[model samples]
Target: MSRSVFSISRLASSCRSRLLELLFPPACVVCGEALDRPTPAAFCRACLHEFAEFHPPYCPGCGATVPQPLAAGKTCGHCGGGKTRYDLAVSLGPYEGLLREQLLRAKKPTGEQVAVALAHRLLQQHSEQLQAADIDVVCPVPMHWRRRLRRMTNSPSTMASVIAQQLGVPLASGLLVRRRYTLPQFQLSPTDRLTNVRSAFRVAAGHRLQSAHVLLVDDILTTGATVTQCSRALRHGGAARVTVAAVARSYSDR
Candidate 1:
């Protein structure tokens, strides 16, 4: 396209954005405050700041916080004895307060703005760890077709897309897929949670990781059942390394 055409197109898009803003007026998704201008993320500065990173003393295995700091290579009780599939984990913070509120919103179609904003914030904070992993592929824990259609959004995938773009990594959005629907993990006992998601995921046929180092993105982690199963699938499918990235981790069963 010619420079003149590109300029005209940009101008037209700007005008359309301004017109929509005048009609609907934007508000922050978290605090419900009015936005001063139109932007992809409708989050206000105050609410954005509230989405803090989970500090250290967290388990290097699953990103779950420990009561006290441990040695550099320590694993928490849940992750010890070779129980999990992912190599390590990172998260925005523990699941509580503002983080929990925003995650719930991000699960809804109406929360796309919140989801995207959170992804960018995550990249800002965890870029070093995520990049240091030498990530070769970015994948989201896949939602079942039926559930995804009902919810009209998958928060994890939104996050994976943003992180993948910022890192200039290939996103294999469909690399791993849920084989069947299981009851929400939170509703089941930790023991039952393991059973519920066990063998529930697999690398989709015709799509395999090439001994890749994967960054598996998800909205939350509790017992880590779902992601464990997903990581197992990735490992079996050809991912040489699997690192979990989530918005929050909760000790819901405890």
Candidate 2:
């Protein structure tokens, strides 16, 4: 394009931004306060400051919050052992308060924007480690096709797209898939959670990992069953490493 055309295009984009700002002011998702400025993460400055978010030192294995500044190593009991087959894990924080509210909303079909925003929030919060993890590809914990068709939106994959784009990695979607639908983890006993998701996932046939390091994304981590099972499939299918990422993790209240 010519210099004149470039300048006109830039000016038109600026005008569109300004017009939108005037017509619909940006507001915080949590507190509904008008934002002085907004990024894709979308929370206002005050809410960002006041929110009780998760921070390290993270448990090296399961991504659970370790009370002290511990280095990465083994599976923490919070997620139980061996079952958490992923090499490492990271989470936005424990699911509670506004964070829990956000996740619950994301489960609905109308909550696509909420799901996308939460993915940005997770990436924003864990930017350093996630970006530095040397991940070759990103994939969401796959949903069963039947349920996905019924719901009309797959929140985890939707979140995974943002993560893959931000990380400059391929979104290896359908790399892992549901073999059969299982009951929701939250409804079962911790032991049942294990058996429930066991054998529920499998690596899709043509997408062999060839030992690539993978970052598996999920919207929530409750008992850790689903993700661990997903990781098992990835590892068994030849992934060199598997790390799990969740937008929120639910800890037992007791």
Candidate 3:
């Protein structure tokens, strides 16, 4: 049975690859370099290396860049002082430069390819975190149904699903549901931001969620209120522990 399943999976993957080549083929999000043949989903060799590297010995709590030789990994003053719900958060890097442009384009109407590419890059950075963490299930920071209907895709959820697939973990879509369509968070003040996202999410009760360790996935972590709200919902729905993983972490006061 296992053999049959593996064979079927391989066949399905091959078919998908062929289809991708047939229509809307893969290209590097950075330089428009061809990426269809690359094993890892990213830009060409040069552009891929240009991405900022997040090495270990960093803060396990916030994924913040920290100077080494300290008692622990890279930890900022704020995280060490405490005020976060999720035990830890990991991000690939700040969403700036080419990375930010690519991510924004992906969220736009005609940037599906960029989204897929960024999802691949995110997996490469977070794979070890996924394996080492006590994560039993994966959930995405969902977009409101109305926004999803208008945008035609939930970029964060799509990226999360791809990461889950790569990590061989279960992607539970129905686990976390958005409750309200708040205004664009960028324009809101910090206080209003928290208020806006408060009670904005709910996790459904089910076999996949009860007492499970969840990794909440998203595209970016800015003020972190979005992730915090999502984590609250997951915890309220009986998540034992929740960890956040994002493609980029916006650096405040940088």
Candidate 4:
């Protein structure tokens, strides 16, 4: 399909979502109330107010919201005094309230609209960060093909496409790929999650990623295992820098 037609299709899908809201008047994904027009992540006013937002004093390296200012040169527990591959990771809200519900919805068969809306919200929230970071490409954490076929789509891919549209960046879905089929990371212990995803990704050969700054988009950053592995794959594939961005971050690192 022509690019213009493809864009219209996406816009049509978005409009369909709005129509569904008008017909059903979607209950707040969290608090169960009608949503305002131009909804952000399909949240209602009360639920938006209830969301736990993340703010500054975050670790510059890892981007986890620092609970409190740490001693100079100290790192957050999640960063764990070890280095991370990505330049930084930023999230809009904590993994609770409406934010959590929308993220979960993004995983469901019916969550595509929420995923796209959340991606737009994320891009708006990080406009400056994205612009300053010189993000040249957007790549989503890929799902294994078997899982992708069953899910009918990948939430991260849907989100990345929306982000690319808003930011005018190129969405590079084929650059990095999932090679292993594994159990859900959430079901595993933090340490096990890290081990489970290690080496699960590979970059497409001859992609020429060298010196390219990337925005790695995903729905949530829990143990950071998934992003870490994806970032490593990107760097290994010759990306100059990778910055992680997600809709929410899990409150506890442990």
Candidate 5:
């Protein structure tokens, strides 16, 4: 009797989904091609295939792809200076081509669906690395209140929430707060980028991250300044270690 009831419920849900699809046909977020059925991600197979994944020969410390392969645990020239505050960083892919287009779209109001799809992809591809890191909690690089209000959404927070849920880790969304508004990192020189975000983040009081391993989520990693600053704040708040996980990395210093 229970099995029969479950089957009926499943059938009803299938029918409802078909009805909805009929009412509003699903289209690929990237290409606008009609989809035969709903996909785990909103991308059509062709567009999904176009999305590149980052393969190694990358800097172990910063996750930046090196021009040539390096031995295990080797740092790239850029990260060899020991200047980064985060223990390590990882990104899904380079910030160009399809990934770039999708990420830019993700910043707009109409891009929530695609943004969610991208987050799902990020988790699918990087879950193993994240699990190996043994993170205790996940946190998004917080946006200033004013910017969040203006944007009506924080993509990093959204991605972090999804990642935390998938990894069964707690998300400390409120623990890290941005105290100052800084110029966009992309617009600043590498040196200026460092100063721009200096002292911009503060960990919330009463939220002790003592010896916690934190995974910091952000949409894009450029010069690494933003995440570095965020990592400093997390460490100051007593986090034992911080690792960054971003959707894309911009290789250009600018």
Candidate 6:
């Protein structure tokens, strides 16, 4: 019967998975600790606990963790400075501990699995806020074609695809394009970082972003200059609002 055949197929698949696990034991992505069973999440329990999530008392505009308590309705210095073009920004956690290592790994060719795991975690933590934002479209901060070719993968695009799928929103990957390849932002001073990214991004021709609520996804937010420039381009393209989401927030310069 068809039912019997289906049961046999499932059994075979389970046996194959178990055999593979025995042949090549799975290890945690962050610590290389052995896992009892195969897991797509890629992190072991101890390593997962080390990932610090950004909580309340953080900057609503830039998602940077505030060192001192502030009265409600007051903005952090970073937000008050008016450097970022996006209306709001949120991140999974500050760039440190296990989260930092995971992000570094996510940049390499073998780190796609880790990146997917991080994206899923981001979705789980901020799903409610993302839903409330009423985003019309999701777009990743684009990388220059040459850079993307060398990297073999774009983390922002990978994260954005997962977010769009979970949110049931359209992902406009080509809506914004990075025209010029610049040096990595982390190496530059804060002022120089702004200059490095200025006028580097452009909205793709014929892409109608007018009046659209766009969610801009990136891997890590350091000085916010890159996202700010990208936001400006989206605004010029007629996007009504822009919100940024990233896997980590770097406090090195802040």
Candidate achieving the largest lDDT: 6
Judge candidate 4 against the unseen true structure and give its global Cα lDDT, from 0 to 1. 0.79
Name the lDDT value of residue 89 in candidate 5.
83
- Residue 219, candidate 4: how far off, in angstroms? 1.0
Q: Write the per-residue lDDT of candidate 3 for residues 1-254, one digit (tens) a residue.
A: 69999999999999998897878566665787776475557577777666574566556556656676335333466454445778678877666776677778778777766677777877777677778886788888888888888988777777778777887888987788777789877777766778999999997655446688998888877777888898888888888889888777765432
> Global lDDT of each model?
0.83, 0.81, 0.75, 0.79, 0.83, 0.84
Clashes of each: 0, 0, 2, 1, 0, 0
- TM-score, each model? 0.82, 0.91, 0.82, 0.80, 0.86, 0.82
Task: Kindly list the per-residue Cα lDDT of model 5 for residues 170-254, writing each as its tens digit.
Answer: 9989989888888878888878888999999999988999899999999998778889889999999999999998888775462
Candidate 6, 145-203: lDDT as tens digits: 88889998888888898899889999999989988899888888988998999999999
Q: List pairs with backbone clashes in candidate 6.
A: none
Error of 6 at 212 (Å): 0.8
* Structure candidate 2, residue pairs in collision: none
Tell me the lDDT of model 1 at 253.
Answer: 60
Against the true structure, candidate 2 has what lDDT?
0.81
Over 81-117, each residue of candidate 4 has an lDDT whose tens digit, in order, gives: 5567787887777787767877887888888877877
TM-score of 1: 0.82
Candidate 3 wrong stretches, greater than 4 Å: 1-27, 34-37, 69-75, 78-80, 205-208, 252-254
Clashes of 3: 2
The residue ranges of model 4 lying beyond 4 angstroms of the native Cα positions read 1-42, 67-74, 251-254
Candidate 4 TM-score over all chains jointly? 0.80
* Model 2 lDDT tens row, 1-254: 99999999999999999899888888777677888875677777776655467777777665666677553455556755444577778888767777778777787898787788888988888889987889999999988878788888889998999999988999988899788888877778888888999989999888878999999999878777788788888889999999888988786431
Write the residue-wise lDDT of candidate 1 on 41-64 in tens digits: 557888766766566666777776
Winner on TM-score between 2 and 3 is 2
